[model samples]
Target: MTPEQNRHAAQLAFVASGAELNIGTPEECPLPVDQLVATRGDEPYVRERFSAGLTAHVYRIHAQGQDWTLKLAREKCKVQNVDGQTSFLNEIQRRADLRHLKHDPLLTDRLSAIVDTRYASFRHGVLLSPWIEGVAIQAWDERQLLQLFDTLVALLLGGLFEWDLCTGNTLDDGQVRLFDFGYMYRFDPLRAFNSNGTAMPQFHAAERFETRQYFAHLLRLEQDGERLALDAFTLEKRIAVEAYQGLRAELASRGAAPVVLDWLDGIIATWKRALVNDVSELYLQEAWRSHWLDLHDDLSGQTCTPSTLARIGWLERTARERYADVQRLVVVESKNRLFDQLREARQLAQRWQVA
Candidate 1:
C-alpha cells in the first residue's frame, strides 16, 4: 500500500480493534446494539433479505415505525482482494465523510441523492441506513442522467470518488439515489483526478459510470440496433460534457493544479469534437475501452459472472469482424493474439461465476 493507503488502513484497523467504533449515536438505532449486531435477517423486524452482495448481507427491517437497511459484513468477502476484505470498513469511513460533507451549506441540496447513514460499527461489522423505496433503473433518461451527473460533480469537488456505479448500486424513486459506499474512496479535490491521484487519468467519474453501468445498457441497446446504442451514447456524452465543464470550473475556482485543470480540458475537448463530428468512431472506441477495462476488473476480482463472459464474447466478435477498425484504435497485439488471450479469459470467467 502507498503511504496514504497505509494510513487509511491503519485508521480502519483501529476501528476494528475492538474499540467499539460507532459512527452515529447508539440512541439513534431503533434496536439494541447487541440485537442489531447479531441479526441474521430472520428476526421479526426483517422485512426483506438481500444476500446477493459480495461483501455483505443486507436486510430491510421495520423498527421504530420506519424501514432501514441493515448490512452485515460477510465472514469471508467473495471478492479475492484486499479491497474486498476492507470494503465494509471503507464504507463506514465514507459514511462518516459523507455525513460531514452533507453538513456543508452548499452541498446539502446537491447531495440529496446520497443516502444518509443511520449508524455503523466496524467491530460489529454492521451498517445501517434508511431503506430507500427506489427500484433499480432499467433505462437512463435525461432526468436521470442530469441528476446523477449533478451529484457526481458535487462528490468530485467534495473529494470523494465512487468507482462501482453498477446497476445494483443505484436506485430511482422519482429521483436517483446512491445507497452504497463500499467502493468509494477519498482523494484531494484540488490535486487529484481520482482516488489514485493524477497517476491514472484514464479512470474518472464519467468513465467509471460508463464502464461499470452505462455500457451494459448500451450492450442491450445494440441488440435492437446500432442506432439505438449510438443515440444513447450521444445523450450520455452530452450530459458528461456538461458535467465535466462544471467540474473543471469549480476545481479551477478552488485553485486546483494546472495539470488537473488541463486534464479536464482535454477530455471535454475530445467529447465536444466527437459530438460535433462523427460520434460513431468515438462510440466504438469507448465501447471497446469500457468492455475491456470492465472485463479486466471482473477477472482480477475473481468475481466473473455471465456478464463477464458476455464482454468476452463482444471482444472476440469485435476483434474477428472488425479487426481493421480495432487496429485503428491502436490495439498493439495481432488479432490472433487477442483471440488467444480472450479465449483463456473466457475460460477463467466461466469458472469463476458466483453461485
Candidate 2:
C-alpha cells in the first residue's frame, strides 16, 4: 500500500480502538445529562424533534427561557458504516479543538458562523448548543458563496478540513452557518490539500462543495436544461476561482510547500482557461464526477436515499448514451474499468437502497 493509505489505515484502527469517549461537563448544558436523557418523547421541554440527522437525534428544547439544540448520539447511527460508527467520537474531538480556539479573538471572528458548543461528551452521548434560527440554503447567491468561501479559506488555512458540506450541515440565517463537525478533521494546510495530508489531491475544498451540494443544485437546474445549469456552474466556478486565488496567495505567504502551490496554480489555470475558452465541457466533467462520487458515498454508507437513486439512474442512463464522451474525456485509468465500476455501483445501490 502507499504510505498515505497505510497511515490512514493506522488512524482508522487507532480511532476505532481508542479510549472511551470523554464526558462533557454538565455546567455547559442547562440541564444535567441524566435529566436530559430522561426527558424524552412528547416531553413539554422539547419544542421540536428532528429525526433526520444520520448520527444523532436532534431536538429543539425550550428550557431555562432559551432555545437550545440537543443532539444525542444514536446507539446505532442510521448510516450503517464505519464512518457513521465513529462520527460521534470524531465530532467530540473537533468540538474540543474548536473550543480551545474560543479564546483567540481572530479565530473567534473567523468562526462566527460555527455554532457555539455549549456541551459535548462522547461518553454521555449528547451535545448541546444554542439553537440557531436559520433555514437550509435553497439557492446560492453571490453573498452566500462569498461568506462560505471565507469560512472555508479560514478553516483550510487553519488546518481543518470539513469532509461533509451537505445541505443539512449548513443553514442561512443572514449569513451561512455551519453546525456539524462530525466529518471535519485536522490536516497540515501548508503541506496538504486535506485531512489526509498530501494523500488525496482529487478531494479538496472546492471539490467537496461541488460533490456534496453544488452539483445537486445543478441537477435541479438541469430540468431547465443545459443553458441554465451551465450558466449556474460557470458563475460558481468564477467565484471559486477567485476564492482559490486568494487562498493560494495566503497559503504561499504563510510558507506553503511548493507542491501545494503548484496544485493551486494548476486548478486556477484550468478554471481560468475554461472561463476564457469553452466552459461546457468543464461543467460536464465536474457534474459527472460529483454525481458519481456522491452515489459511491451513499452506497458505501448504506444510506441510499431517493437522491442516490436519482444519481444512479442518471449515471446508468448517461453512461450508455454518452459513452463516447464519458470514455474519451473522463480521466480514468481505463474506460473499461470505469464502466465496470459503474456496474458495480449500480449493483451495490440495488442491494443497499434505503427504503
Clashes in model 2: which pairs? none
lDDT of 1 by residue, 114-139 (tens): 99998999878889999999999988
* Whole-structure CA lDDT of model 2: 0.82
In Å, residue 192's CA in model 1 sits off its true spot by 1.0
- Name every residue pair that clashes in candidate 1: none
* Best candidate (score: lDDT): 1
Displacement of residue 345 (Cα, Å) in model 1 is 1.0
User: How many backbone clashes does every candidate have?
Assistant: 0, 0
lDDT of 2 by residue, 1-355 (tens): 7544564565577566755555356776787778776656488888999878889889999878899999888888878766677788878788877776656675678778788887777766888889999999887888898889888887887678988899889899998998999888888889888877666888999999989888888887888887988888888898999999999999999999999999999999999999999998888788889998888788778877777767767777777778678766686545567668877877777777664
Candidate 1 Cα errors over 4 Å, as ranges: 1-20
Candidate 2 lowest-lDDT run of ten: 2-11
**True-vs-predicted CA distance for residue 191, candidate 2, Å:** 1.2
